[model samples]
Target: MYKAACLVLALFAVALAVPSTYDTEHVWKAGNLSYVVPDNAVLGGFDPYGFNTYVGRVIYANSILPARVVVETGVAYFNTETLSSKLLVYDILVAERNVNYVWVRSFDGFYEKGAVAVGTTNKNERVFCCRAKTDGGVLIGTLLLSQKLCIIKHETLALRKFDKYEVLVAQAKGNGTLY
Candidate 1:
């Protein structure tokens, strides 16, 4: 009986040592859109100097018909030299209503406020919009789709129209490549 109990305890300890996976679910009622990040979607690793790093891809879909509309790939890194963590998001592609567009909001390092929006073939139709803040981390933003535009600011969600004055800013400050 003592040996059996010891074996059970060892197995439990091993299970507890394993890292837990992340699963995210986001919903937008006004746009009838839902974004799901499945468990084990992100793969993590360590650099030669023992810095932590992760890479993942997230797919956004329409709730009603369950069609894929957007895909985003992001990379997160923890630098031991600076003792800081940073996330770099790349390849934000949107496909809706038979129209496809690429959003250019890629940023390397950390940022306080960033916004990216993509529209369909029609000039007045907006497919989606994403806002990122350092306080809340990544994957925390409002997703607008299907002709509906929603804006989430400071945790308050509102349905609003796309601003015509909004512009896309691409700043290349360092010697890094822009994709």
Candidate 2:
């Protein structure tokens, strides 16, 4: 009886030591997962200004200041001629502080860390995600950072300010390269 009890305790300890998929630390580390923002929804699917259009690859719009573009790398901007033909793919980075929130990275390693603010430059603080549910009983992808959506500031993308904007929820697509 004593040996059995000891074995049981040992097994329990081992199980406790094993990391869970939802473990905060485990999510913080980058994994073999990638996602694409095929399109976005706004105002309960009353998408105007082509917010529901395809998001394309990252480009340095300004040649004079390359760093500026790098700083604003995470979100997609709209230029029908420039961004229409391509799609933007991002890698998932779970937030260290809150596993629920996530950060996205561009193919060139630019993170969508909110609206490129002046003071909130810390990477950890820029975690964003879509709300699980909304008033319309829809899984709307309102990509929020610090509870605010950043657009228009950099011509990244345009949507009504008060309305929630949706993002394609990132799922585990296996270790794949983001195009």
Candidates in order: C-alpha RMSD to true structure: 19.1, 17.7
Per-residue lDDT of model 2, residues 18-123, tens digit only: 3312213222222121433212211222122323212122222221000111112333322221221111322233322222222233222133433221111112
Model 2 alpha-carbon drift over 4 Å, by segment? 1-52, 56-123, 127-142, 150-159, 172-179
Per-residue CA lDDT of model 1 for 14-105, tens digit only, reads 76554322221221112111343333222122333333322222222211111111223233222111122333422222222322122334
**How close is every model to the real structure, measured as TM-score?**
0.20, 0.22
> Residue 128 CA error for candidate 2 (Å)?
4.2
Residue pairs clashing in model 1 are none
Error of 1 at 32 (Å): 32
Question: For residue 92, what is the lDDT in candidate 2?
Answer: 30
